[model samples]
Target chain A: MTLWLSMLGEALQAMSANKLRTFLTALGIIIGAGAVVLMVALGQGTQTAVTKSISALGSNLLIVRSGSAQQGGFRGGAGGLPTLKTSDAQALLDLTSLNTAAPVVQQGAQLVYGPNNWGTQIVGSTDAYLDIRDWTLQSGRPFTDTEMNSGMRVAILGQTVAEQLFGSADPIDQSVRIQKSPYQVIGVLAQKGQSMAGSDQDDTVLIPLVTAQRQLVGSQFKGTVSMIMAKANSAQQLASGEAQIADLLRQRHRIAEGADDDFSVTNMASIASTMAQITGMLSILLGSIAGISLLVGGIGIMNIMMVSVTERTREIGIRMAIGASRKTVLLQFLLEAVIITTTGGLIGILIGVGAALGVQRFGGIAVAITPQPILLAFGVSTLVGLFFGLYPARKASMMKPIEALRYQ
Target chain B: MSDIIRLAAIKKVYDTDAGPVPVLNGLELSIAPGEFVTIMGPSGSGKSTLMNILGCLDTPTSGEYWLDGENVASLDEDRLAEVRSRVLGFVFQGFNLLPRIDLKANVALPLVYQCVAKAKRLQRAITVLERVGLARQVNSLPPKISGGQQQRVAIARALVTQPRVILADEPTGNLDTVTGQEIMTLFQDINKESGVTMIVVTHDARVAHYARRLVYLRDGLITYDGSAADFQEALA
Candidate 1:
């Protein structure tokens, strides 16, 4: 053990004596490790961002939209049949697995407050809409059920619309005109950022379904709804709740057996998993590319170690003559290689983390830096050193003492 | 004193593109412990080959060789290295000190292989360096000192192991006449004071005069082996 330690000391001394060469030799590993770290951080950050956006759509929620309708030989896309209704949403709430349900009516309208006017989505829903979508108010309160039933002109402004209409000023109790009809803004919704589909969730206004149907949408859409948003009791109940809703809707719609249903159920969990799969694959792809660079770094180490072995042939001979065994010589060179790579690995980690933080701070992109990948990179770099250092170290150890001593 | 090195009918052959080249042909020699002997020969006379075999750096192609009562001719590579470390120390013509490390570390190289503790190895190295009159140059690197000092450091490294024999191959070949004489004087003092067995291989007659016994090799055979004074008188 003492001999090994001394050999390690000798290796370190030799490396330090050629600081520039050592640093240059380790550069390949440094860049490789840095690239790996950055790519992983970005991948993790993107995954987190995607998950956040998906959850922002609502937790354990499902959306039921009217399915494509066939007219003669022409078939439309999903949500073209407009078969969903307020009664379907009401019946969906009766399921034990469902926490809440809201029938939705959506239209694009011009919202005007004073001199400012903005075109935005106007969604009409019941009081349960906020609870089902996991939305909270930034200020004031939701409209009463009496108001919804009475078709009163009250509105809840989303963060984007509120900013356009009121700026920093509070919009509560203020009057706004939606499609030429005056309405009182009851509350402002909290910032929801972007949805899973990459659309801004905060660029809309909410009003009671009856009010939208009676005042703006006209009587033609009185009984029907654009979609229904249903929340399951928990994440685990989503599939069963979706099944019960589907069975109930099929029966209520009086659809024939084995026929395509008039509505489509979209599970948010499924969308989330698919998105996670895509991002996970992307991370692996990036990680593999970075791994290739690490392999190149290992080759760089091998090349330099070969040169070192050749240059120090006489030194090795002297060591052998003085009593150093082949094992000692091999170990010394291996130690040098490991030290170089590990040092490079550590530096790479620092640079990678710094780059991640830099991207977060300056690029305005979310970056998650975890310990697992860092440790993995470190362990891989050490192994690379061991593997690449082997051939050169073996060559050094196999030198005959006489031939080595005679090396010029 | 018992014979520390015994070689009987030892032969070394090197395979080359031309054919097999025989260097040492059935050579026989023996040296008792505490004896200082010099082997002198011209280039290609197998003096270096004999030194290499004697130092366990290379094994004879076929022979019965005993070193310190062990049959070294048949020993494996690892055991040969072990024997080299424990029983023999070598000084080369070029000093062969690792230039990056300090004098003390260079002198302590043998003990590092022996797995000696750091403090004790340094202590022994310093003691030997002082014996070679290099006490003040312990912390200096080899290149920072003169060639004579570097050779002394080499000698100190050889002595630090307290080996049964010290083998030197043309120890003063790279030094000037005066430095060479100084190095030879140090070797003479070490041999006379400590009774350490020393075998120096050189072509210089003045260097060979430092040894008590002189052996002359020609055409892979020992032409003369006797006291240095007798060999000098015979040459005259």
Candidate 2:
């Protein structure tokens, strides 16, 4: 053990003597390790963000969209043409298996508050929209039932709309004109950042469903709504809730058996699973790139060590003559290689973490870094050193002292 | 006195693509403890091969060889390394000190292989360096010191292990005449004072005169082996 320690000391001395060369030799390893750490951080970070966005979408939601329109047998999947009614959403709330059902209608309009006017999406939903979305108000309160029933002109401003119109001032009790109609702002929704679709969630203005239906978007049909978003009692009930909704809607519509209903019910898990698959594949791709770079780094180490062993032939001779055994010489060179990779690994991890945080700060991307991946990166780099170093060290130890002494 | 080194019919040959070539043929020689012996010969006289064999760096092709009371001719590579560290100290013509290390580290090289504690070995190295008149240069790198001081550091390294036999191969070949004589005199003093055996190989007759005993080799055979004074007198 003492001998090994002393050998380590000597290896350090040799490395310190050629600091620039050592670092250059380890550059590939540095890049490889850095890529590995960054890949893990970004991969895990993206998954977390996806999950957060999914949950931010709603509480275990099953979204119901109107079926595709058939025009001369040319069907496009963009089928959001509003065939469901607000009555259907109200009827879904009768099912005990559901937590809440929010009927929604949407339109884009220019919102004007005094001298400030900004174009944004206007969401018309029942008060149950807040419960289904897990949404909280930053100020004031949700619209009352009598207000929604009477089609009163009360509104809740999304954070971005409030910020644009008020700029950190209290927006409650202020009046905003939507499509030239003045509505009093009753509440301001809390910040929700971006949704899973990468669209800004806070760039909206919310109004009661009946008010939007009567005054804003529902002039074509008597009681039409764009969609119904229903929440299940729990995750396990989502499938059954979807089935029950399908059966109940079919029966309500009085559609015959074997006929395609004009409405579609989708389980949110499928969306989540698809998102998970994309992120999982992304992590694997990033990991493979890192693995390939590590392989190249191992080769780089091997190449440099070969040159080092050849360059230090005379030194090996001197050591051998001074009673250094073959094993000792081999161990010495191997120790040097390991030290290089370990040092490079540490530097790479530092750079990766720094870059990850930089992305989080400047690029506005979420990145997660944990200890296990760091340890894995470090361990793999060390193993690469040992695996690649063995051949060159073996060559050094195999030299005969007489010929090595004569080496110039 | 029991001989510290024994060689009986030791033979070494090289297998070349041209054919086999014999280097040492049926050589027999021995020297007692505390004796200083120098082997003198011209180039290609098999003197270096004999030095390598004596230092345990190479084994003889055939025959029995004993070093410090142990049979080492048939020992494996690791055992030879062990024997080299425990019983032999070596000096080379070019003063083969590892240039990257300081005098203390160079002198402690053998003990490093022997697994000696760093502090103890370094302390012993400093003591031996002081004995070689290099106390002031103990921490100096080999390239920073003069050729003579470098050779002195090499000598200190050889003495650091305090081995039974110190083998020097043309120890003063790179030095000036004055520096050469000084190195030879240092070897003589070390042999006399420490009671350690000294075997030096040189082509210079003047350097050979420092040894109390002399062996002369020619064509892989010993031409003369006797006291240095009588060999010189007979040649004269």
> For candidate 1 chain A, which ten residues in a row score worst on lDDT?
A213-222
DockQ of each: 0.76, 0.70
| Docking quality tier of model 2 | medium
lDDT string for model 2 (A350-401, tens) is: 9888998998899998898989768878998899999999999999999998
Which residue pairs show backbone clashes in model 1?
A: none
Query: What residue runs in model 1 are displaced by over 4 Å at the alpha carbon?
Result: A76-78, A112-117, A179-182, A196-198, B17-19
lDDT for every model?
0.91, 0.89
Please list the residue runs of candidate 2 whose C-alpha ends up more than 4 Å from where it truly belongs after superposition.
A42-51, A69-81, A94-97, A107-121, A148-153, A160-184, A196-200, A214-220
Write the residue-wise lDDT of candidate 1 on B1-236 in tens digits.
27999999999999999999999999999999999999998899999999999999999999889999988998877888999999998998999999888999889888988888889989999999999999999999899999989999999999999988999999999999999999999888888888889999999998888988999999888989999988888889
TM-score (C-alpha) between model 2 and the true structure:
0.91
Scored by Cα lDDT, where does model 2 land?
0.89
Best by DockQ: 1
